[model samples]
Structure formats: C-alpha cells, structure tokens
Target: MVEPPMAEKDTATMKPVGTTDPVGITVVVPSYNQGRFIDETLRSLLDQDYPNLEILVMDGGSTDDTVERLRAYGDRIQWVSEKDDGQTDAIAKGFARATKPWITWLNSDDVQCDRALWRVAETVAADPAVEVVVGGAHYMDADGSNPRPYPTIDVGPGADVRREVFEKGYMAQPSIFFRRDLYERVGGLDRALNFCMDYDLWARFAASGARFGKVDADISGNRWYETTKTAGQTLDLYAEILATQHRIFGAVSPYFVQAVSDHLYGRFHSKFYGDRGHLFFRWLYFKALWTVINARAPWYCVKGLFCQTIAKSGPIAGDRMTFKDWRDGFKAFLRHGREVRP
Candidate 1:
C-alpha cells in the first residue's frame, strides 16, 4: 500500500495542523458505463481536501466516455479499465489493491458529502479501536435533485447491529467505512453476490464482533435513478438479502419475510394494476389474506405488513415520521386508491 501524502502546514507556524497524521482511507469506486455521472462522483471525493485519501476506480471496460473522463484525473486516482465479471468482481479487485488502513467503496453514481472523509477520519481517530464506522446519507433523484434523507439508526456499543441491519435494511452502503484489517479478517466481500453484498459484509462484521461507531451527519449522497440496478428490482434485492441472511445466520428473519411479501404484492400490483386504481386496495387486501393463510408466522407477518404499509405511506420528506402521520398517510392511500409518497 502506498503512503498518503503529508498534511499541509499552517501559515503562522508552518507546522502541520488539523489531520496531520490522519488515518488513511481508500475509496474504491466500481463503475461501468457511468460516464454521465462518474465525473461528479470523482469530484466529490477529490474536493474532500482530506490529506490521507486514496481513490481507486475499477471499471469493467466501459464502452462509454468513462475511460476518457478517468484519463482526465491523471495520477490523482488509480484505475484499471478491463473486462471483469461484474460490479462485485470489480469491487473485489479494488479491495484487493487497497493499501490504506481504512477502506470503503462509493458507487460510480454516488457522491461523498463535503468533508465526509474528514469526519470519518476524525471519528476513527477518536476511537482507534472502532473497526467499523457508519454515517448518514441521502437518497437523491436521477438528476441529483429532490434529496431525501435515507433512513439511519444509531448502532451504539452493545447494539445488535446485525439484527437491525437485517430487520430494518437501513444502512446506507456509501456511508460506511471499515478497517482494512477487519475486511481481511472477514475474508472481504463475496464475489458471487450480485446484490446485497454490502449487507452481507455488514453481517459478517457484526457476527465477528467488530466494534462499530456512528457519525450523525450525512456523509454521502446515493443516487436513485430509474436505470440503476436497484431501481425496479425490489423483490429480487430483498430475496438476495434474505438468502444471504439464511446462509449466514442459518435462519431468515420474519421482518425480511414480511418485506418479501410486501414487495411480491408490489410486483404483482405494478404489473397488473400499474400501481394505481381501486384494484390496489383489492390486491393489498388479498395479499394480506394470502399471507395470513399461507405464511408460517401468519399473525406476525400480517402485523409487520400492516406496519410497513403505514410507514411506507408516510410523508415523502423527512427522515422520521410519527405514527399519526403514518396512519394519515395510510388513510390517504386508501382514499386515493394508490400508493402514497414515502
């Protein structure tokens, strides 16, 4: 691993200040055919002004202008554009080359918030024993507008981080950083997984008894566009997540079962009813009834489905919502015969 450049000096005393000997962080950006958005993503990291930063862009031989844009960065970043298996493969390759003490990956379409690296470094520096650091992030639209805070929960000491992640599915991938040693100890990412690989890594970290720390401030922006891999594949994503959980924990959680059922209904509703019309209510009711009749834990599944429905129908903006707000949103969904904004 290459050493990061030394910190800049203060004008008055000409002595290094701020992050003079900050912990190094390597950001691996796995990309392919993301020419339109890669530049902004790179700039976000470059502008962090964090001295101890290393960036690696592993491109899967993008046919777009992504290579040209990468060339523009010159030596500021290390990159390899070649044919690879997939996103997971590219990220695994980058991870293998990561030389920094700490490591994380930011997707080609995502951007790091201002000073995010600094904040992460400071948090890790404050507690050198912390093996993982999780922060907040926002869900941005395709055009980078309409930013909404992604759901985040505090995973303090002694907290069941793995259970919270499996049940709530709230950890933002880009907002997470971990020690390279922990990654090595956990055997890094599973190259076979197409989706939910990040979730799998978190599960491994927690199961291994890794110490976790949280940063309350938003540290990344995760773009959610129609063409993205996770956009219309809710059912598949959750399925993979559940599979990973089953493989790791030897049993899948009820929360994930409820999630699968809800998304199953969503897939059916979107395909047949276009997600609107009076048929929406009928489909939802039928799905609930089907769950009650067919599910293993019928009552728990029904209750979880009910709670998720109300929660998903809550106000479109804001990170948190009250129960009353969720109930009103559900009422609005019932009245309008469509899914409410969330």
Candidate 2:
C-alpha cells in the first residue's frame, strides 16, 4: 500500500522557546447533557496549574443543566453552548478556535489527572521535535471510583507508530496531547466516523511520520459505565475500527481480526452457554475451531489463539495478561471443564 506524505513542521506557527519556558496547550472538551460530570471535568483542567493553558468547552446545545454549569465557569473557560452536529463536530469547532500550539480533547465525562498538563508540557518542551505526546489513563467506574490502569503500550525508541496503532490500537484519546500544526497537517479528525474518530486521527498521525513522546504516568480518568457510548455500542465500535484499519492499511491486521473474533465468541457464549455451566468450554472450543476455519489465515488464527490464550497479546484495549496468569487460568478451566475468568 502507498504511504501518506511525511509531516513537516509549520515554520509560520512554530515559535522558538527556552527549555524552562512553558508550552501553551489547548484542551477541547466536547459535551452534551453531561451536567452531572462536566463540572468535575472542567475542574480537573482548571486545577492543572499549567502556566500556559486554554480550555474550550463545546456544548452541543444540551437541554439539561449543562448550559448552567458552563455558565458557572464564567471567564475561567472559553465555551459556546449551541446546536452542533455531534461530538466530532463540536471538537472540530473548538480546534478551529484554538490559539495554543499544542492541543488535545477530553470528553465531558472524563477528567484529567492531577498535574497531567505539566507532564505533557514538559515532554514537549524538552524535545521540540516531538509532535505527539501519549500518556497513560485509568478506567473509572460510573461513580468515578475504583480507578484501574488502562493498558497503554509504550511506543519505544525506533518503534513504528503506524504499525503499532494499526495492529494493536494502543492509544487512549483522553491521554493524548499533540501539536495543533501536526493535527492540521494530518487533516485532523474524520467527520464521518462517529465512534473511532480518535483512532483514525492517530493512524493518520502515525502515517504522516510524526514523532511521538511518552509520558509514563496516568494523564486522565476515562469513566466507564453501561450508558457510555463505548460500553453500549461495542460491536459498532469494532466495526468502525476495522473499517479504519482497511482505509489506512488497505488490509486488516490479523490482531484486529482476532480481537473481533474473540468479541464474537464472547457474545455467542453469553447467549448460548452463559447460564449452562456444563456447555461453556464446548462452545468455546467449537467457536475457536470455526474461527480458525473461516479466518483469512488459518495458521495465523490458530497461532493468535494460542498466543492470546498464553501471552495475552490480542488487543490493547483491555487489561494485559501474562503467560503465567493465562497458564494458571487455563489449568483451572481444564480441571473444571468450565470457563475461567481472569
């Protein structure tokens, strides 16, 4: 497949700075009817204490108390509460109005970690060539409690960002900070995608040969609940992600296919053998065999199943598991002839 053009620095927008100088960052927050959570989200950024920062809230004309909450912020944040197409549209509007050199977006339901902005700024300021800064995040429950580390793989030195993003999908939207010029250069977020716009943007950023830096700390808290878009529309999300893979690489990655297959198996198992404890492993084995037969590469699929079962290297969206953990779980599953939970 033909590769996209390389990213070039925008000299007109690039400003020289000292090592000690703070880098300006624009954070775009897209919201709709998230009155209960938006306040905390706004407060997280406001409390960052980063010397140079801009917080813009783009509300998609929420009918709830969201507008009142935005008004409560007063001049602390730049906001526009009006009708917009959707979350992607609101983010586009906010990005268009951004004056800072570095930019990122946080959903109204999510909150940035303490001093997260400082970590991002310091990384960017230390290396002027770094166009993207990727940090870690935590999965918070609906009540914003029990925060667990979100699996964020470090794109190490000389690692291919495009390959990692395309194959493993290893970045979190809330934990990402990138340069405004680099974003504009990569053509920004795709308007057509309702679910995987951030993933598509990362793929484009990687394809453009943009340099990336890692912040080895949790930068944001991504709240997870049944009502959330990600939790509710998981199948649709995977469909969008697969479509994005095809669009970027002209072929779907086997790792992504394995992830899709695993998701399908889980749904099937839940529907057919969820309550029937005896038939769990039987259905799993049957599904595995069927998946191998239908997969584009049968051997690759079999190997993936083994590695996923052992090394736990299928997808980065979920918590990673080690070989020893998987081996112990497998032993228990075999001994009881039932499904095992890790």
Candidate 3:
C-alpha cells in the first residue's frame, strides 16, 4: 500500500494522544474551520463505549477556535493542526498514521449518532466477511425545519452495488465504516476529486467485490450549514457522479443502463429532479425510458412525466414530495420485479 501522502508539510507538533486501549477501530476526522461543531463531533467519538477505539483528527490549519476547543479534550485524542493540501489530503495523512484494522473518517461538522460506533463495531464483529458497514443518517440543517431520516440503499446479498450507488443515491458518509484492507486495496479516497470523492471510492470498492452490510439504523447526524462543502457544487456533484462511474464502468456499460432505469423509476416514484440537471441527464433518462418501454416492464417514461406534471401542479418544480408520498410511489415502481433486497 502506498503511504497516504501529505500534500504539504509544515512544522506542527502532533497532539499527545493519551495511552490507548488496544485500539481496534481508528476514525480519522478531517476538519477545517468547524469550531462551532467540532466539540460536539469529538464528544460523540469520545463518548462511544467501544473500548478499543482511537480518534485521529487531521485539521487543515483551522483559523477558528477548533484547535483551542479540541485542547480541552487533553490527550484523549491524537491530533495535528497543520497546513495540508485540503480535506482529502488531511484525511490521507491521518489514514496513513492509523494503526487500527478497521477505519472510518468523519468530517468536523458531522456528529456520530447515539452509540453509532458501538453499533458499527458490533455489526463488523459479528460478521467479519462484511467489509463495509453502512447505516442511515439524520440530515440536519439549521435553516431547514428539522432533521429527517435519509434512507440508504440496502447493500447485502444479491444487491447490485453499481445501480444502488450510482442511481439510488443517498449514501450517508458519516454512517459508513470499512476494513483497512479494503481501504488499502482501493488506495483510499482519490485526491484529485473535490466533489463526489466518496462516491468514486465507493464505486471502486464495489467493483472490487467488497462485501457490504446495512445496519438499518440511523448512525450519523450530518449538519448542512450554509458553509458546508455540500451546499455549493451542485453542478459539480451531478457531473462528477456520472463521470466517475463512466470512467470505471465505461460509457456504454449495461450498468449505466440500469442506472438510467433506476433514475426513471425514481422519476415516476417521486425521485426525479425536474429540469435541474445537465442535458446528459435528460438524454440518459430517455434511453432508460426506452429500455423499460421495450421490455414491457410496466414502467414507462410517460408515468414519470405524469408524476412530474402532478408535482408541478401544486407546489412547483424541483420540490420533493413528502417521504411518505415518495415511499408510496417507490413501492409501485418496485412492483415490476425490480425490487432490491437488503
């Protein structure tokens, strides 16, 4: 495995991590200017009852009180505040230093759900074959009303990793953990990608045939404040998702056909984004619609058009239906022998 490179190096003393208790899981937190929430994030990690857990935080030279705030934790956490390349670089640096067999990373603004690490550890302990463990998450935004359950695709026996990841959407970053071997095999997160880096990594791991487990529980509290990395980059997010998948799966792979099929199903099932994506999205939608149409799969482009029409009638375009409405529609879409299993 290549040493996770540090894009830049500076003279910054590493935090004096207190004596660890035979660490089994190491979570590398990559943070920058997230002082408002970093304390809570650290608390969630420290408060985990899982004894053999270690916290390695990599800060990209936070100008805020992030360092001062973390200082209160004393030697409890192993940390370094320095000038690094970026979030991905900081993560790579921390990952290289991690000695735990199982590893995960949490951004500074995110908080681990109640007993999240414990649940992850429990699941992985029970089934060593399950290389990646993922759970649902509570997406919270201060401006938005309240936190809501962001459903994750069920990845397990007989699951299609490509379709679920590339098409189904909604994989919680904070709620995921994988073995170190998988990390080393895939070469960790790609430093070149600013957006969709996690998606790219997941795609490669899936292609590598890594086993997956869904915890079926909410394991992360992901904040979506104004300054969050996700807030901007809407265009880049959409473009990179397809580009990364294409780079690996090829432009004409049948997997992409399934992706379009899945997207169309979502369109009818209240999952489509109306007139808000790149032109290629429309082209893909048409092709996928043709596939379902020719197969007589009881799913058609017209149905989604009708649904979109209804959506635009009352509220407006681009507004999502309530979770209940979307779930109801999805059940109908799954009726045509396309249901995915957990």
lDDT of 3 by residue, 6-25 (tens): 22222353211332122278
Task: Enumerate residue pairs that collide in model 1.
Answer: none
Clashing pairs in 3: none
**On residues 1-342, what C-alpha lDDT tens digit does candidate 2 reach at each position?**
111112232356332232354678899999999999999999998885555789999999999999998988788899998999898999999999999999999999999985788788668766878999999989999889999988775576888788888767767789999999999988888888889899889988888889999988888999999999978998898789877876776556655665665577567664664533223333344346436443655665566556543114444445555545545655655765544445
Evaluate all candidate structures by whole-model CA lDDT and list the values in order. Answer: 0.77, 0.76, 0.67
Please give the range of 10 consecutive residues that has the lowest summed lDDT in model 2: 1-10
TM-score of each: 0.78, 0.78, 0.69
Q: Which regions of candidate 3 fall more than 4 Å away from where they truly are? A: 1-23, 143-145, 252-342
Assess the local accuracy of residue 57 in candidate 3 as a C-alpha lDDT between 0 and 100.
89
